[model samples]
Target chain A: MAFENYVNSNESYTSNQFYEKLLREIPDLIFQFKIEKDNTYSMPFVSNSAMEIYGFEKDFLEHDAGPVITDRILKEDVKAFLKSVLKSRDTLTRWNHEYRVLLPKKGVRWLKGSAKPEAMKDGSVVFYGRITDITANKEQELRLVLSEKRFEFALEASMGGVWDWNLVDNTVFYSEQSMKILDLDETEGINSFENCISKVHPDDQKEYLSDIDLHLKGITDVYENLHRVKGRKGTYKWILDRGKVIERDKSGKPLRIIGTHTDISSQKEREDELKKTLDIVSEQNSRLLNFAHIVSHNLRSHAGNFTMLLDLVDDIQDSSEREETLQHLRTISNDLTQTIEHLNELVSIHTEIKIARENLNLYEFFQRTLNVLSEKINKHDVKIISLIPDDIHINYNPAYLESILLNFTTNAIKYSNPERRLEITYQLTYEKGKKVLTISDNGLGIDLEKYKDSLFGMYKTFHQHPDSRGIGLFITKNQVEAMGGKIEVKSKVGEGTAFKIYFNEKV
Target chain B: MKKFNDVFVVDDDKVYHFILKNLLKKNNIEVNSRFFENGHDAIEGLKENSKNGTTLPDLILLDINMPVMDGWQFLEEFRKIKGTLNKETVIYMVSSSNSPFDLNKAKDFPNEIQDYFLKPVCLEDICRIFLN
Candidate 1:
């Protein structure tokens, strides 16, 4: 008998009621769904399972299941549910599907269902199906898929490689991406942990292995280390190696290890370069600061002298005193002009090291310099001895040489000693493969011991002469240095002074 | 009779020395004046004056940027034996540098080092030091 007949024909049997009641005892759903040719849906048969699954009375659903079933189908799955049902009905075949449903009392659930449909003479279709709860299996499938997708994306985006190791057998499986990262094309595949560790740099292998040991010992959650790895060109590249003990035995011993290695060679090089550049910039910045301070002080002195000298000229009334004031004014203004000229020269001297260097004969340049200062030489009655050989030559900037000679010779005559006749000597020689030119004068020699530190410093002078503006040696030093040379001085008080020039000490 | 008994001028610039001397004379406030070309020379003069019972200047105007020793270096040397001097003297840092580095140095100078004056010291600046 049809189960509906059994229930209707033997209502008096308590087992029939017991089974009707037993349907409520279990959670499975049993029902018969039908669709009229008019496409209206209805439930022809619903056991007590309707109340358990749909939270409704069987009697109520047998008459009104059309709206209730479709509405409770979890709107997103309703279309597919209808499509599957229609296809099964039109083909007179079995309907098999898994989908989500809204159980008013149970929030929502995944139901796996199958049904076979039959057609009536009146063109009505009917189906019998059972849908059971499969929420646990569906959720497990989803979590597994999502985790797999995340791991795949991580390896792809990291542009690195993944490695898995079986600790028990000492075997390692390197993914295709991992071999590609290590630039290994052999398809025989990496088979041993020993083989993988052998490719690591000798200096990094010890630490890399220890990290894995620590992770396996349950001392660390993951093996995190950074070291160098041999790359394709036999050059070692910085690699950040990270891994974790993914599986362990009952004794908490490591069973499986998985990890990745990222190339960090370029990043490491950039960091080191930045560190070096920052150091250089800091040193140059300080030197520039000192340069600015000296320049400002020199300019201030000249300007300050001019301010007072002009004011003094305005205050003088006596004709002779006014003339004296005017004379001093001319000298002060001349110093101001020279200071500005020195400043302008420094701009070129520091930045224009590209000046042309020529093989300059020392004697030829000496004769040219003597011509420039012939008037001053005669006025001071100074005797200059040229001890340089006619063939002796040095690579030097012509303009700088001229200025250097003019400054040194003019200073020699201007600061000449009044107690004795002025005699200046020039000598050229080479020491230790370095070309040297020495200029000596019998003028009032400076106390070198006292002024040793500041002899070549800017605006430093020792003489009490009115013409000693303190700019000649400063300029001469700059010019000589620009041509890649150094100046040395030796002096004794009241006797004589000597200046030696070393032409580009290459050795 | 004059306002200042004696003054010591320590500067590298002869033009500054000449201007200062004339300014003192025109203001008619000078007595005997002593001059040193640099801080080193001034230090030596002070040492000699301290050894001999000579008259130390009542006031000293010191310039920075001298050849051998700058005003700061001179002050360092002066602080060593200033206590042995028979006379208490006031010294001023006269410089063309308006840099904060120099000014802060002067502000922290020893008590005997009186004050600082930027270049072109006029009659008024001189009177403020002597009259008080």
Candidate 2:
């Protein structure tokens, strides 16, 4: 009677309602298998969903499921999966393995199979297993691992370090390479934010903290700053720290930050050295311009004088006055010879002589120069008015000072209008550690607009005077610049001219 | 040779003027040789002569470099004076400058300048003027 009842219940469970409920309950194909003699397997039951998984009818797999399993299991992964299962059976433990399976009428797919061992009362071992398709998940995991390897190679090649921060836990995670960059042992724990902060220079600590705070407050999505950090060798190195907030909370608050650090000390040093070299080149260029002006002026004046005298000698005749003419000729020739010697001396002035800085009395020097030109001033009916203070002095080269003053005085006399009496005035002032000397004249002034560029050029003459050689101002400009001074002119066509010279004050 | 109403020597150098005046007297140039220290003085004299309808110089020996104004500036101003002085009067540019630039510039004023002479004007050079 009990055997009849079991058969009757199985018949009722196979009804359409019962089968429909079973298909809905288990969307995956379900099967029950029983082991036979010598490596053969038998299936007593198979669900209708088996058609969806293996593209076969349930009746075909009802007696034998081994054919489907063997046929669908990829040739390469079958041996490994079988070996794992056998080993797990000997140990009487569960088995888990991921293997590729070739589906009928479908491409190959990866499946994760897990089997549980059941102990029977007859001392026989039986196994039940479920296979879940994990093809997409396995491919994604492989791609992630490859990308990580590429990032590691790139970081190493670029000499960069990677870091990650956990905002909620206040911990920092540094990669092995990052630890190496900080000169720290890779095995040491760098799991706390304090460990990273401790390596930063004291001066940069505030800035580094502010950058992190700004990122956390959602002020910015990225933080970049340069800071010096103490390396494992206790040497300070310049590092460019760049990071972006990667993980954010629902409120758009940054939960985690990750970034890189690169050493840029050598590049920074090269940039600073290049700037210093450029400054020196510009300074030398200014000096070269002043030197060129001096050469053009001095050389052309002597040449002009020589040419004029030679032309005059060719036009003269009469033996009676020939001797007197020869004497005048000798005087002019001597002047030319002296001018050439002066030019040679001026050229040698650039031979790196150390300048002797000393205090110089302006009034005393002015008086001395005035005395030297007194006879000419008297003959020309000229008056000199000095406004310089007696105690006021400047640090300068004495010879340069004398030359500047002499040139100005002679120029004033030479260009003076014959109809009016000549008057020259000198004034001195001090400002911002600089001494300024202003020499003004009531003689014929220069047209600054038209001749400003050529005023100090060689052989440049604006006045139609016979004595104009256009060298005095040129030499004066050179002397001033050689002594670390600067000169400027202000003049109009008929009004007089004023030369303002500035010099560094002595300590 | 044709006699000129007036002759002029415009030069900055005094020795050139002295030699030129003596040469003119020896040749009996039959003209009053006027001397000017510079182009400025020479221009003033020419302007005054033009205004008064006085006889203009038949010939002018002008120097290039002079005080206040140069021979080139004198010629520019001399052209503006509207009188019967054109075509009949001849001007000679005498310069000590051997610059080819100056020679080319003189060629531009061919109507005003009859000839260009280098320094140390000699009798033979003056004779060329009479032949022209």
Candidate 3:
């Protein structure tokens, strides 16, 4: 009734005057509607802006909205428009609704309507309201929603999830992908620093903590850690974690640390497998080298026999000596033929012995070796005084050490002073970061001044012993060098001889 | 008259001693000779014979590859006692190995190994040293 009073009395001017004033003063579409007792509604005042908004003639909207407005309202929003009108009809309250309209040439447009309702004494209702073109705001809102969805899709494709740890609040947020990488349920999971640390393998925790500390101290620009974290399946998985302090407070305290985690378990396993394969290849190479040495040695022995028989056949004098020489020559020929047959089958002298370097318990090894040579030692009454300490360990190949010790011990025994009990002393010490092993013996000492050059030569003998094939020292020297060590000798004619081996550890 | 008074043949190969003794006999060298099995036996014999002031060899032929003691090992101990010896003994180093390495090694011992002889020593190889 109050809105009707304004509509009926305040209309000092005619309906055309009020609408003409509205067209000049107002930029929005304005309207006034009155319903008759017969339930027919007519818009008494529909401004000229309606012609601009709906692209229709001003006379076209002056009729009851039953055909014009109802047909123009979007099909989907027609109920919302009707609901607002019905609420305004009974309650006599304000009507406000946003809806869409399909116009003649302007296509679809968005509009907002607001009106105050009044009841007339003639059992009719009147409404004075305004409709706004809100298409720009709605389009901008739709664009924002579309861009957000595109960003989320891109993140999912990258398998990347943002994570932020609020250092100040001691709280953590793991995005869906990040939670899934940590083996935590992506939909429902909370990852705090304590839980993350607990998931990390205990052995890697110290290194992880140290790296984080370095990053926190600003020593590193970013925190990087390659470590293993226990998964839901209870197996540890390797993770390549990279993070940086994304935000800091005024006092330079870290406010947030954001990062990403990549599952690198398969890559780490591949590296380990490659290393094992390399080890196998190296072992095979060593076996092949040993086979080559033995083959050469066999060839040389055969060649030596051939030359010896050739000499015997070249000279024959008396009939008795000729018969004997021919017989010996025939036997040597048979031996050489057998050696040639051996050449067809490649023989590895020490193929089964893989060179493994580790800390060697010298005392235990020395005792084991002494037992092996105990028979000869006891026969010769040799005293092997091991000056090496029980705790002295050397980084050397086990087989090389065994061969070197055996050669030195045997050489000492063979050249022992026949007039006295043989005395051999062995000791080990570190010299300039290299192990120096000295094996000295009070035996028939070598005349170093005369035979020093040929001491380590093949088939070069320094002492006259029946069993001296003159190959031991040469092979011993080779074994020492193959293990990255060097051998040297010092001797005095009547005093003694000492063989020293210098071994350096590989880093 | 024979060129040499006595000959010492030190070798592990019985064939060398037999062949050398036969060649010397065939040539009517009329030289007294002693056959030692290896360098050690020869060294000890020479030491004992020299200490007793007995006649030592005028010419010595030593094989390089003999068991118990090699020719090189004998030369080492030979040098130390050579000054105390009574006789002036000419030395020759012989080996079956014709390797250039062994030849070069023999060249180093001018006083001890006067000539290096390879095996299959025809009488000519020995005749060149004494008859020449």
Q: Which candidate is the best by DockQ?
A: 1
Provide per-model DockQ scores: 0.29, 0.05, 0.05
lDDT of 2 by residue, A333-447 (tens): 5645655654564554455365666788988999999899889988998888899999987888787788778888888887787778888999997757688989888888887
Off by over 4 Å in 3: A1-361, A387-395, A432-434, A462-470, A505-507, B1-5, B12-15, B18-32, B37-58, B64-91, B97-115, B123-132
Worst 10 residues of 2 chain A by lDDT: A1-10
Shift in Å, residue A284, candidate 3: 24
- The better candidate by lDDT, 2 or 3, is 3
Model 2 error, position A144 (Å): 14
Candidate 2 has a DockQ of 0.05
Off by over 4 Å in 2: A1-319, A338-358, A379-381, A417-421, A458-469, A504-507, B1-6, B18-32, B51-55, B82-87, B98-110, B114-132
Instruction: Please give the CA lDDT of all the candidate structures.
Output: 0.77, 0.70, 0.74
Q: Which residue pairs in candidate 1 have backbone atoms (N, alpha carbon, C) closer than 3 angstroms, thus clashing?
A: none
Best by TM-score: 1
Q: Candidate 2, after superposition: displacement of residue A370 in Å?
A: 1.2
Q: Report the interface RMSD that candidate 3 achieves against the true structure, in angstroms.
A: 6.7
Clashing pairs in 3: A1-A119, A464-B68, A464-B69, A465-B68
